[model samples]
Structure formats: C-alpha cells, structure tokens
Target: MKILSDTIKNIALEIRTGKTPPTSNHEYFGEEINWYTPSDLDKGKFLGKSRRGITGKAISDKKAIVFKPNTVLIGAIGDIGKLGVTSDFSSSNQQITGIYPDPKKVDSQFLYYWLKAHKQSLLDKSKSAIVPILNNKDLGQVKILFPEYISDQLLIANLLSKAENLIAQRNDSIRLLDEFLKSTFLEVFGDPEKNPKNLPFTTLEKLCSVIVDCPHSTPVKSKEATNYPCIRTSELTNGYISWDSMQYLDEDEYKKRTQRLIPEAGDIVYGREGTYGEAIRIPKTHKFSLGQRTMLFRPDYKKTNSIFLWAMVRSEFVYRQAKKKNSGSTVGHVNVKDIKQFRIYNPPIELQTQFAQIVEKTEVLKTQYQQSLQELENLYGSLSQRAFRGELIKY
Candidate 1:
C-alpha cells in the first residue's frame, strides 16, 4: 500500500458575507457578481455554464472575491463536498471556497473528480450545527489518495479529457437534432409569418385521428405481476422509449384499468403534464402500455407520418400551442380533443419523406452517441471506484 501524508494551512475563502447592507438609496446591492449556489451543483463533475449572475458593483461593495477559471469550486454549506472547476472565471456564493493547487501541484480535473468521487466522505467528516459545512481549515487537512508521481495525475487527466470530449460530442449531436427540426419546420411550412401556406393546411383533425391520454389517474396499488409493461411520459426521451425503467402491472390491474393506453407501432406518445408537448415515436419494438401522464396520438398512418408528427411535437410552435390549451391552473395538461384540434401543415409526400430521412439519420447517430455516453459514464464510474480504493497503480 502507498502511504503519503501531507498537511497545509488552508484558510477559508469567501465572497461577501453578512446580512444585506441597507443603503439610504437601496443602490448598494446594485452591482452583484455572478454567484453560483449549492443548487447549481447538479451538473455533477464540471460546470460549463451557470444559471444566475449578479451585478459587478455588488462584488466591489460586498468585497466578494473573484474566482479564477482554473480554480476548483467547492461548496462549503449544506452541500459540503460537491466540487466543480470554474471553467469561466466566476464568483460563488458566500459559502463557497476556491481550492487553488500549489502551482502545478495538482491537476484541476483530477482534483474535481477526486473530490466528486469522495463527496459523501467529505460530508461525513465535516462538522456543522445547522447545515453541513467543511470549513477552510479542514479543507486542506483532508487527505486524498495523492500520487507521488505527477505522471499518474496527467495520465488520468488525459483519460478524463477524452471522456469529456465524448460528452461534448453527444451534446453537439443533440443540438444539431434540435436544429434540424427547426430547419425542417421552416422548409416545409415556410416562416408562418412570411408565407402562410395556401396549401390545404387546416385543423389537425384532417391529418389523423384519435389523440388520447391514458387512465385519468395513477393506477391503484397492486402487487400482481402483469404480462405487459407500463411506462410513463417521464421515461420517453428524444422520440425513443426505454423499457429498462418500466413498471409491470398484473393482469387483474390491467383488466380493471380498461382505459390504460396500449401503444401501437408508429404511435407517437407525448408528455401532457410536466414536459408538455414533448413526444416520442413508439417503435414497433416498444412493447408496453402507456401510463397516465403519457398521451398517445394514434395518427392515421396513411394521412400523416408518425415520425414527422413526433418531430413537430418537439417544435416551439406545438409546445406553446399545447401550453395554451392546458386544462389545469398550476400543473398544465393536454387532452385528446386539444391535440386533434392542433393544426399541422401537410407538406408533399416527398417533403415529408425528406424530413423523415433527416430525422431518421440523426436519430441513429443520436443512439450511437447515447450508447457512447453511457459506456463512458460506466467506465468513469468503475475507474473512480477503483482509483479511490487505492487499486489504481501510480502509472
């Protein structure tokens, strides 16, 4: 076993801390800098972008410290151990501390992943009354499995860098798919503003029929194992359905919920509740029943291409339209009637096929990208588990 111990004085670092200073004009808190909160730690390892930003003057008035892009951003409050690298120079909440390596002493990526892999442990070691926090004093004292060889750190960094590249590619593919949809809509329908088509484009009722939701509510608790799989809208992704996380209903339960939705091949299932208008095409291979939140529109295959319809659902126009017809006050929902009444521009078969081809090709590439990401995540999981366990050699 390799044993290495080192201690260094790690002082607490913070941005402006203290109650909001009241100013005579209320302009003191005007120029606030970007402050990432603990809730922003959901990106897992690396945070490329942030949601909130404060004013620049706020930093000066509050004496908030500016974080360098290379520094390790660590949360000190409730989320005591979560870690990320400040890709873009930015400030963090008062409870955040920037962990700077002693010039070339550590790889930032290595540090981020090390802390991320050991997040729970750091949490356990922290001491706090109201909220868990690892003060600056304890931050440097916390010993991690630091390699004596810098080469080992660089090697791991390279591997992780490649993994990061794969993730970036996946993100790009997703963006491109969205772009293709946007482009397809513009090509087929032309800008609804510039040239509102003179084609026989009318109410969505003309295209297909039968837009239906599942059982009005969640199924009653039952233990009976059914022959069919029941899936919810939450499970759909990018027009594909995954049965890996599906629930199995018993025969009796299925018999009782007669309205339970059965997805037919080419049936486009849409999310009517949370992610309203988000839809997935039910491939023939998808053998399952739809849950309550899922609304399946069995399009007349002869009139409308299900693939085209699924792509349309992902468009901004349909999303806004669905939101408009939503029934509930707080949590919006879409019903069958609302869906059929929704209009669609009927392009020629050639145009429909051309758009379908683009979507189809992009989907295939997306599937490959998804698989690559999953494999990379799994590999990272294994590598991290082994590395933290002292199983990884100092290569």
Candidate 2:
C-alpha cells in the first residue's frame, strides 16, 4: 500500500478558532448564523444547525469566525477528538478548531473519516490539564496519512460511509427495541403518572426485601482489569448496566465494599446523587459491588419482581416524586429516607410477574441486538483503519 502523509497545516488552506460574543451584550446573540460548541459535535458527518447561534453583530465585531462549507471542525477544548464538517457558512464558539482543507490535497469527507478513525491519536497529543484541551498548533500538526490520488480518497470515504451507515442502522435497531419495551411497559401497566387503572399503591420499602445504600467510601480501583467490578452511576444507561465500562477493584476491596450488600441477580441498583433515580437490574451472569451514590433494592418475590421495581424507579411518576424530595438541594440527590417513602402503583403479584416475564424476553432480544451492534461497530472500525491506510483501494 502506497500512502502519503502530511501535517494538517500543510493540507489545509487555513486553521482558525472561534470566539463567543460578550455575554453582557444581548444584541450580539441571535439566529443570524449557526454557532457550535463541543457538545454540538456528536461525531456526525456534517455540522449544520447548532444549539445556539450568534447574530451578524458578533461576527462583525470580530468575536466569531465564519467557516465555509466543507471546512472540518475539531473540538479544540475539553472534548479533544469530536469531529464534524461544516455544511454551510457557519460560526462556532472557541471550543472548535476550524480547518479549511485544501481541496487539491485531500477530500473533505475522507478527512472527516480519517480523523474519526484516529481520534485517539488526537487525544494523545492533547495537553493533560484539569480538563484536557488541544491547541490549534497541536491540531494543525496532526499527521493525516492518505492516498495521493483524490479519486482514491473519495472511493475510500464512500466505502467507510457505507460501513458507518450499517453501524448506524444497527444502533437504530437497538434503540427501536428500547422504545418498544418502554411502550410495552406502559401498555401492560398503564402510565404510572396517570394511574388510569387506579391500581393499588405501595411504597418501595414495602415492595422490597432489602433497600440498602452503597458504602459512602470510594473504592480503590485496580490499575489492571480484574473480575471484581465496582459499578458506578455512569455504567447505568437505558436500564442496562454497561459491564464493559465498569471500574474494577481488588478482591479484598470488593469484599470490603460489598460488606453492606453484594449485588446479585434480581437486585436493582439505583443512582442517588449525580443522576438520581436511574435504575437497572443486576444481570444473572455478572457479580459486582456498588460504587458511590448508588443503592441496592432486592424485591420481595411475594410483593414485586426486580423488573417492576426497576421500571417504577425509572418511571415519570416516581422520578418526579424523587425530584420533589431533592428540590431544595443545590445538587440534586435522593436519600434513603426519601426513597423509602416513594409511592408507586402496585398491581397484583401475578400481574407484576407477568410483566417481569415479558420484560425478561424483551431484554434477551435486546441483548442479541446489542451483540450484533457490537460486531457492526467492530467491522466499521476495521474498515476505517484499512480504508485510510490505502489498503482498501487498487491503482
């Protein structure tokens, strides 16, 4: 494979950063032009409409830079590797580094994919500060390895774009499954907020065999991967535990941490501090101890199942109730006392168990979809790597 490489500065016509208009002046902000920040960069191929915009006054006042169409935007601040290409004449805040790629030297879409594939390399060059940041100089110095021919660049970009589209389709499938389960939950058990069925209400405390808080202390995480995972609030997403992202601890630390209650299958882990009230049931195959700001709920089979309790805590009604208890705090949080009093619509045990079974089956399907999505992601990564290396093309 014959590949050519050059610093981003050498390939681009210009490298520039943006600025925010003075907040004291209200006239400087409006919908006159699209303005982006780090959060707006969602790894999308093109940067279009943004969450906020700046008026012409801001641009006229030299507070922002207008990046032309096909200009690549890389996150230059705390989020170092977020990549996107400008779809129109757009402006952004200081967090974005705008690159106008020299059309003769590199294809815009190819540059986007190449940067996407090597985002970690950009991260490596970032200055390790409290919040990691990449400077324009460092960004301009990023080495882009590419085919000398623009036709090959376009071909490689198109191939990788197809792979990305497949990966995206797989993600959409997984998300649709989640939406299906959520709707099904509401169908089986009427909206918790509405309580249209007027089902009998019960406190979570009564429905559970055990409601215990995680140890207040932080676990000393193992530098190397270990079997003993310490589950944190970050790992709780979409009613599932992201086992892969969990921090691990030594066996001794794990034992010490689980001294209060070792989380097992059928137990619900609830986040209490940061993202208060998000909950997920512990899977049957995994064993782990709770991290900070989390509590465990063990459903009493006689009253409710783990699925019911987990869903209830995540429901709009219970979440609103939980928020009410924490309304006074500067940082939102739920305490054991408040959690114990949370009222929920409690249907008959037979009905709860039926719903539990339905959820269990749906989860199994979701797991399969997730596995497929992982494989697609792996394929996309491999394709991106090879496509940029000149291995996917023939002269």
Task: Provide the overall lDDT of each model, using Cα atoms, as 2-decimal numbers.
Answer: 0.66, 0.85
User: What lDDT would candidate 2 get against the real structure?
Assistant: 0.85
TM-score of each: 0.76, 0.95
Model 2 agreement with the true structure over 177-220: per-residue lDDT tens digits: 88887787798889977788789998989998999999988799
How does model 2 score by TM-score? Answer: 0.95
For model 2 the local lDDT of residue 41 reads: 90
Worst 10 residues of 1 by lDDT: 10-19
Task: Return the clash pairs for model 1, or none.
Answer: 31-55, 31-58, 32-54, 32-55, 226-249, 226-250
Candidate 1 residue lDDT tens string, 62-172: 644667666677778776765667776667666777776654455667767777777776676679678887777666677766555556766666666676677777777
